[model samples]
Target: NWRSRIVFLLKTNSSKPMLHLIGNRPSADAVNQWAESLDKLLNGTTVFSIFLKSEFCKENIEFWTACEDFKMLTSRKARASKASNIYEEFIKSEAPQEINLDLHIRNDIIENLQEPATTSFLAAQVKIYSLMENNSYPRFIHSNLYKKLCAAARQEVKYNKS
Candidate 1:
């Protein structure tokens, strides 16, 4: 009967749109796609950040998020200052948490910082995104931490229904 009831709900629910009442349950595919899931997993929730921090890659997500936010600045003055801050903190050699990037990317960012427009971080951000997508994201999908979070979400939903 539980299976029958579930099937019944699926069939009947089509009559009225079914909204996702629970939150943060990203699908397996979403976990792999960059733009679709990275923001919510990395920036929107503490779970992913906490796990990343433990594994020593939190800086990657933080830098990526800062780049995205920095891109949204409308004022030239704001963009310039933020660009300088990002370069000093994330791009410079011997910085506290220097990201691994190609020399060409670093040099391009250096050149862009001369003017420091909104798009100054574009090339560097792409490189970082690719790094995470190719390297970190797969580990994230398979990590025990992510599995625990998914289990916790399921438990929460089950408990809420009772």
Candidate 2:
């Protein structure tokens, strides 16, 4: 029934579909392919971001991405400054976008921040990654936003073929 409803909507929806493009018109297979891995999902497009934001867990991905960027710094000073900013923003207690982390891990990160290295946030980043991979990602795979994206992708494929 729900599947039929989606089909009907896809059929009757205006020529201007509410499509969120990730590069060229993505295939339905591309959307489905992301379900295989968290990295794929994150690297795929803004669809995951849109879904996560809708679920009020956008900070999870934000923190994860920040950690990734933090890992790329070659300069000690830049790494230290970036690490402090990351801690204040996401790891510190009462931070603006404080992520859910174990007290021990949080304390460990605080200690590491004294001489922050590119790997300083590795553990906390892993924890956040697990949280998203296990929790929000599953929900995202089933969300209306994900479904709409797949449907729109299919529609676009059809439109392009004609």
Candidate 3:
């Protein structure tokens, strides 16, 4: 039922089937179906959707203004949130084995807080943390602060043992 509904919606304007592609347009199935015929056409449709949306948004100031409003919408919010998880995966892979990710993120926020241009982005982060903590703090201790505290704790441990 769902597949048929999707097929119907996609075919409403054109009789051609829309290939929902991610990565590459001419997938194995499309290539197998026509080999060379549908390749260019399918790729063109995907490219058109992307470039057309960008141009349309730029042409209409109302559409540009709606970027934030659209983000509040379920579809846009889901897409936006996916980017952060992708970034987190990259961070985990690139960071040193012993580095604490939570502390790393916090430290990055603190570093950004020092810059006036980035104040708004940092403010959003602080508000989220504040919500999690369930109380207000005089200042947000970012990842760098956490690292320094951990280092100090280690030094204390070493001194006590000696």
Candidate 4:
């Protein structure tokens, strides 16, 4: 039933790219062609900076340290609290960080990959930032860029441990 549902969804969801391979049918070439087309369209374009705010780690301090590049604003609970000082303090402390072009490639890989993939994609953010800094570009981020960054970040976080 789930496989049928996935097939039906893929058939109907033309807006989203098809998974290419399903069951025994091979889809590598089709997927590769589509990916090449997408690559041409997005070349030289950067999505910009992303502000990360996730509920995944909750209050775990280790998670906080790992994501030091992100401005760890308030906890999710603080946002929902009766008094939001904790959230306010968190925001006040966060230094700005931005997304770099690495996000675009990681997303492309995840979208085209057949098997479940890991979250090592997030490491791209660090690598890209380093590249930008080496090239002498100032670090700047924007809110809208988070969509791709979050997708790649979530994917990396999802597959990293395994």
Runs off by more than 4 Å, candidate 2: 1-17, 20-29
The full ranking of all candidates by lDDT, starting with the best, is: 2, 1, 3, 4
lDDT of 3 by residue, 1-162 (tens): 433433333334533333332224333333233223322322333322232233332112222222223234455344445324323322234522111236555455335332323131233333333332332111112222222333444554566679
- TM-scores for every predicted model: 0.72, 0.81, 0.16, 0.18
- Residue range 1-162, candidate 4, lDDT tens digits: 334433343235244323232243212332223223323212322221111122121222222233342334244342234112222222223412223334455455345233312332235435543453333222212222222233334444556657
- Clash pairs of candidate 4? 49-99, 119-155, 119-156
How would the candidate models be sorted by TM-score, starting from the highest?
Answer: 2, 1, 4, 3
List per-prediction Cα lDDT, in the order shown. Answer: 0.66, 0.78, 0.32, 0.31
- For residues 1-162, write the lDDT of model 1, one tens digit per residue: 333332233344243322233244444343344235555456454445555566688777778888989989998888888888888888899877788888998998888886787777788888888877777767766765455445544555666779
Preferred candidate (lDDT higher): 1 or 4: 1
Could you tell me the lDDT of residue 70 within candidate 3?
28
lDDT of 2 by residue, 1-162 (tens): 433333343444454445543345446778778878888888846667656766789899999999999999998899989999999999888999999999998998999887898778988999999999999989988766666777777777788889
Q: To one decimal, what is the Cα RMSD in angstroms of model 2 from the true structure?
A: 6.3
lDDT score, candidate 1: 0.66
Q: Can you give the lDDT of residue 79 in candidate 1?
A: 84
Clash count, one per candidate: 0, 0, 3, 3
Please state every model's RMSD to the true fold in angstroms: 11.4, 6.3, 25.9, 19.7
What residue runs in model 1 are displaced by over 4 Å at the alpha carbon? 1-40
Model 3 reaches what TM-score against the true structure?
0.16
Pairs that collide, model 3: 106-143, 107-143, 107-144
Which residue runs does candidate 3 get wrong by more than 4 Å?
1-142
